[model samples]
Target: MWQRGAVTDSAPLDVDLALLGGGGAASLVLAALDRHGVRGLRIAVVDPVRRRGQDRTWAFWGHPGSDLDPLLSASWQRVEVATPARRRVLELAPLRYAMLRSGPVYDRAAEAERRLGAIRIGAPAAAVHDDGDRVVVRTGGDGPTVRADWVLDSRPRPPARPGRTTWLQHFRGWWLESDRPVFDPDRAVLMDFRTPQPRRGVSFGYVLPVSDRYALVEYTEFGPELLTDAGYDAALTGYRDLLGLPGDGLRVREVENGVIPMTDAPFPARPTPRVVRLGTAGGATRPSTGFTFSAMYRQADQVARALAAGRAPVPAPAYPRRHRWMDAVALRALDRGSVGGPEFFDRLFDRNPPERVLRFLDGTTSPAEEVAVMNSTRLRPMIAATAGDAAHRVRDRLRPTRPAPAIPAAVVATPTPPPGTGNRST
Candidate 1:
């Protein structure tokens, strides 16, 4: 059983939880809390954009019958990894590669909130203050300030340095219908690093086929390169040419473009007392992988359990400081140019078992497994750099009396193994 109430000027709108952000992360947390039987908590989701629209796609590896199975809009049993040197066709054994489009997820979440009752929406928060005993959230409209015992902020952080090493992981996909069937709809082209490598960073082409005649082709990168309309035209031309496909045979449909952070700067976790951060703002996304939905869900579960037990939402069991450190190490490697982008991933996949790799990305691998994974990358340079960086970071932490060095402006921004490469068929 849960309790629900509205805040009045006299009562000051005190609720159990106040969530900022209406994106996937916030929704997942709300859903998890609801499922944990933490009911009647006056919840408010604040976001500037409330309408659901197609944004980006989320892909993750999961067991066949996982809890997230129902949320998947599409999935593939077979995935292909291609590099200039070699190609590997893997069957996702015991696990499947799943994708959930953003629109449906947002719609589902909105409906869920309505049914659950006491969950408010479309309230744009102006600012939040920690008053020690309670957190006060000031909003834009006439709505009264929301005071909560706990608050979860999931707002996307602004890039630490603007225009420095800016890269849009953007892509244009033609949901094409071919005159004649060309693609193996059952198989997904995970990475085609066969394209020309960018000198400043790394780039690759990917294709996700939904049917024999329909698929999405996209080009992605890790450094500053904004393609113009003409540039996209030329690149798509080159992609089709390289794939030995006739562009005239396919009919174009929809397109998508997205920019993701690729920096190593530490995202702030402590904002104010009784008000915690969630989603990417909370460092839920792996700085290297830009994957956070699963991590957010896991964190939500922990928070819900804590609330259900009548405990302070302080120690979320899912995200440990150690996991954040590992993400920082990987991001540092990229920022320092210590490893080539493609080769870094190639070595990772080649050395680690798919399951172990998945576990590491999910932030759940044990200490022994973590050691094994570190050795598998054969990233000696990265290993050495990480050790040195770790020592320096620790020393700085201990010597807080010393002035903290300013973090480089450009060094902030930015998981997962697809299952079944060990045994399943494509």
Candidate 2:
């Protein structure tokens, strides 16, 4: 813990790197540095509240043998995507859909911090300034100030510029336990569009079954605004009924909720020579899917490689400019009433191979493959959207640079049943 002290301009601690927030990004950075064999560097991780429990969950599809394999709570070989008209179960042989909880990640980070002899400052960074050669970080309430040659800031901040179309990928999940064998542990439901759709955007149900009787069920939406507390509960209740889980011996074990902004805005990785952004602020989250775990890992690895090479530790761009442009067009189509979410995603998986679609989402597919994937969607509407997005870009370039408004924060509802419910049945 950082010690409280009298206010002073001089920093009490100096290190090679200072992580502004001790969240998943900070932990991943440390892991990446260790993996890249860059060690013995003084490091400090600063945050008012570090995650220590299963406060969140992350799901991504990746090839087997990842460094995070040991920490995975569950993995599914087959992923199911269902619409009202058709349901398909696609096998991800080379790649497995995996789930990770926050608790184990935090525990691993703690061990890494101890191994590196890094300082863990339990205080919020009030201000961070890049003073030419070094970065200065001032903690809240006169806590010890820190100076570092480089800083990876994971604190929540807005995008570098505004985007043309923005939507909130908000979700609320519940851990469920039932006496009846209600779930198939081998198969995970990626998107079950059987739920009620929103008037403007789209809503879907996501289920990850850890066992025959235990699963994490969620209600997700990609829309302009967030649902109210009662609204989400009602949706979840309807979804539970839709799944046909027995109501008598069912229990809500835990709850997790969050909102990720899905926008085409540019989140610059390095704002200054000595100061770089990490996590969502660094464009780790994909504008289309709100998936950040894989991208965060990629960003951390890039930064570690640069540091190991004795170069300016700037992370690579999260996605190619062409991918960003494509995402902007798709987002515009979704924002307008051009296509329904169910049809858009249904054709995405139904037409292309599951692996190709996943690769496209990860921005790894070739131009030829990408054209095929785009052609599967509503081409006419997408083409119109592309023209509009191109015009918007040209207008921005012609106009003088001005500060764009940050993405609006969506309304987040408190998780139901609170924490510590344990295995009690409802």
Candidate 3:
């Protein structure tokens, strides 16, 4: 391994891991390293801006005894889903629909930095190159460089998006506090598809209540592009009107908005094995649902175990090949409007237990259970979608892979992928 030149001391400094970007994926990797008791290894987290605020909320259905147990800000044991004509309620016993604020996560991450003793270089890295045994990271212009035995390139994203199929899960949410008790604090609305949908995509509203008077009201859609500022406001207004939420002496406390990519582009690209790509960059994000939190955690733990075994971390495919193939079938069908999102999801929840459906969406379903879920969907449409998917894959394979142009150091970062959802959506 290449070592840094001596400056203040005689011993050389060589980082065991150089995190290309210090977002959630990189943070989780450090936590995994600490969990596995891999100490005395130099580590560096490179990013320009420190994660700030509780501006984003990450919601997931998790066990009460899991790693996120202590970090939960709010949770609901009973969940509800609705369409214009039908509604269903589900009871989650050991698993609860939970939420964690970004504020607490960032605070705990600070503690990780202190405990793990990682070097935080608050600068943007322009390029990451794998040099056989070591990966050299260079900053723009005259900035310093660091070489590490292994590099996990989790930089926000490549400059050019090359997805033959890309759908965005875009949403805007308002945190509301009411003077009177208006929401059921014990229950959360996973999806209310009673609102008007777009001409091309499905739309829904989700509510997560913190208390009887406080809840998060979100308007979401799976569409081709992100809505305009005014477009989002109009949609939120319409949904608020549909639910009569703006009245009843209610006030908006805080607001947040974000867009998540639901693409069948193999989640960007797979580069070298030595310089492995991380999280969504490595196709960890499920294309059909745009969920990555659970997958990222699993992948980080896997990488740590591989390294602890005195071997290079070769992260297995986050989703099995069959799952990826199935997702591609769904993506093409949805993008072409051959399938309706609401109808498909309603059937999925209606046919299988929510827990089973959730496991399937999380990519943890057994082969038999997966078969049952697939049986619930209309097979003819899937067959058609699969044919198109095959053609797209062929074209994508034929296309040449070009290296990304150099990113100027002045550019800080790209849009960060939003947090995972609590719903068992497909």
Q: Which candidate tops lDDT?
A: 2
Number of backbone clashes in candidate 3: 0
Candidate 1 lDDT by residue in tens digits, 1-426? 223322223224667777877777777766676677776666766566664655556767767886566777668877777788998777766666777767767666776676556545445788888988988888776555778888888777653222112233444444446888888878887777887777766777777887777777776666645566666656766776777777576655555555555444455565667878776666666656656667777777778798889887654533566766666676556555787777777776677776667667777789888888777664776786688677766665675343222321111111011332212111
Model 2, runs deviating above 4 Å: 1-11, 398-426
Question: Candidate 2 — which pairs collide?
Answer: none
lDDT over C-alpha atoms for residue 208 of model 2: 98
How far off is residue 107 in model 2, in Å?
A: 0.9
Q: Which residue pairs collide in model 3, if any?
A: none
The 10-residue segment with the lowest total lDDT in model 3: 406-415
Per-residue CA lDDT of model 2 for 43-154, tens digit only, reads 8887877667676788888999988999999999899999999889999889899998877887877777766667777788998889789998989974678889999997
Candidate 2 worst ten-residue window by lDDT? 1-10
What candidate 3 gets wrong by more than 4 Å, as runs, is 1-13, 159-161, 246-248, 268-270, 395-426
lDDT of 1 at 218: 72
Positional deviation of residue 101's Cα in model 2 after best superposition, in angstroms: 0.4
Residue-level error in angstroms, candidate 3, position 345: 0.3
Model 1, position 268, has a per-residue lDDT of 59
TM-score of each: 0.81, 0.92, 0.87
Tens digit of lDDT per residue, candidate 3, span 1-426?
Answer: 322211222222468887777666777787777777776777777677677556467777766787767777788878998898798998877667887776666666666766777776666788777768888877654445877888887765643435666677788877778888888889999888887878887899989999988988889988786677678778878887887764657766667676676766544334754687777776667778877777877878888888777777667778888887888788888778888888888888898988888778888888999999988887888789999888877876788865443221111112233332211111
